[model samples]
Target chain A: MQVEFWFEFASTYSYPAAMRIQSLAAARGVTVAWRSFLLGPIFQQQGWNDSPFNVFPVKGRYMWRDMERICEGLDLSLRRPTRFPRNGLLAARVVCSHADEPWIPDFVRGVYSANFAEDAEISDPAVISRCLETVGQDAAAILAAAQMPASKQKLKAQTAEAMERGIFGAPSFLVGSELFWGNDRLEQALDWAARAAR
Target chain B: MQVEFWFEFASTYSYPAAMRIQSLAAARGVTVAWRSFLLGPIFQQQGWNDSPFNVFPVKGRYMWRDMERICEGLDLSLRRPTRFPRNGLLAARVVCSHADEPWIPDFVRGVYSANFAEDAEISDPAVISRCLETVGQDAAAILAAAQMPASKQKLKAQTAEAMERGIFGAPSFLVGSELFWGNDRLEQALDWAARAAR
Candidate 1:
């Protein structure tokens, strides 16, 4: 069975899910389809120009504290990004453009680490280039490819498709047509996939 | 160690939480302080006249589906309430006024069952009266007590306290000053309480 793992680079909870999803899915003999999409468009449709966490300050404060506890439990380092949500467009294009490549997973994890752990400006090409290099890809070539019209268009279509599939947030796991949202539902999603296969 | 479980009767997820929390906390040797409060005020403070799920239809659709899976897994019966977010005010008053009484837990669970399992209108006095009677309590006396000025004030104060404690949602757990939101975090909150006691 295959599980589609949808994520956005700037999302805090997606970081932990992106880092661990591969190992967890592999253990269950499930294929992981890493889908990098933009949450900006999705939120915009909901009449939100900023992250819901920012639009609602009370919820925002609780989210950060929750993230700290979640990260601590998972042994993942989390530094609240200096920017509430760095523009993840460039980073998302990189992943969406080379989604099928073997090194895509490493590059994906690298970008998440950069945004969440290292607090690097993810929208910066230089920062994205470093992530590409870390995954042993040609930084200059991939950077050029990511800027192509086709590459940009692919990411746009992916985000639109996310909405079509009933996705409202990042770090969602889709086991067939059944949607499981949030990092907390990761285990349940995987178990569902495993059980369905049987 | 003590864990304060703040819940709302109209909340769908709170059904499974209310049904299972007592046994789970007992296993951890933790005391549970049930705090029943209203979410209407909290949502209004965030400029929402309705449930966030209702204000955002996409979220509402997903929530009902999510609740179905959650209840199925826990072997808890769930039926969509005929009225979405049926008023829990009167029920809250009853629970709040008699919170220290031994029958509070059963009454709380009974009310949740009425709304979620039986699809009874929790706002109806007869419905709440039946719940109180099921717990072998004096339905007339408790219902009368729930209408007293003191009962009304107690619920109001409890809701205000929920806001002060940064509770933006229902089924929240407070272990000391640490807050854990959603029913999924029940184990984690209980674990935190157990560990903190050490």
Candidate 2:
């Protein structure tokens, strides 16, 4: 069985999920379809223009603390980003346009590392290009392709699909119709996929 | 080490948590101090008159579904409350006034079962009295005690303490200064307490 892992680059929990899902899914023989989608539209529809964490300060405080514990447990590095949610539009567009590419996973991890660990501005083309280059992908051509009208439309459609599927947050895993949200639910999702196969 | 389990009777997730936490904590040699509090003030501080789940329909829908899976895994029966977030003020007053009573745990579980499992109106005195009676306590006497000014003041103070401690929601756990929110974090909170003792 397979699981569709939907993530947004700006999501804090997605960083750990992205870094771990590949190996975890492989161990359970669950193929993962990495689906990069934006939470912008979803939040906007719910009357929020920013991340819910920022919209709710207490939650924002708890989230950072929770992320610190999660990162420590996962042996991942974390730094509070200078910008709460540096625009992930360009990075999302790039990943959405190259979803099926062989270098997508490494590129995904690199973007996550840049945003969370290094606090680099993910919206900056330079940061995204560095992530692409690190994965041995042709950065210049890919960046140009990501800006194409078709690529933009793909991301838009993907986001719409996510909303229609009732995704209210990032790092959601869809095992057929069973939707599991958050990084915490990753193991359960993988187990669900493996069990469904049996 | 000890963990303070702060919960509200109207909170949906608190049902499973109340049912399971005592056993789990006991198994880990962790002492649990049940702290009943209200979410009304906390939600008001965040500019909401209703539960965040209800204010955001998408999240509410997801929450119910998620609860189903969690309850199934825990071997607990759950039925959606007919009224969302039935007033837990009276229940909180009772629990808060008698925080250290030997029967407080059972009383907490009884109230949760009434709201979630039986779909009873938790605000109804008859319902609460029945819960108290089931726990082998004098229903009328305890109910009368719950209405005393002293009882009311105790609940108010407890709720204030929860807010000052950065509790934004119900079913939160505090191990000294470390705050863990949600039923999912119960295990981690217990682990933290257990480790600290060693």
Instruction: Give every collision pair in model 2.
Output: none
Per-residue lDDT tens digits for candidate 1, residues B1-198, read 999999999888888999999999999999899999999999998889988888999889999999999999888999998799899999999888877788999999999999999999999999998998898989999888888898999999999999999999989999978999999999999999999989
lDDT of 2 by residue, A1-198 (tens): 999999999999899999999999999999989899999889898789999899998889999999999999989999999998878999899888888888899999999999999999999999999999899988999999999999999999999999888898989999988899999899999999999999
Could you estimate the TM-score for every candidate? 0.99, 0.98
Tell me the lDDT of candidate 2: 0.93
Q: Which stretches of candidate 1 lie over 4 Å from their true place?
A: none
Candidate 1 global TM-score? 0.99
Report the C-alpha displacement of residue B78, candidate 1, in angstroms. 0.7
Alpha carbon deviation, residue B87, candidate 2 (Å): 1.3
- What's the residue-level lDDT of B146 in candidate 1? 85
Candidate 1: tens digits of C-alpha lDDT, residues A87-164: 999889988887888999898999999999998999999999999888888999988988899999999999999999
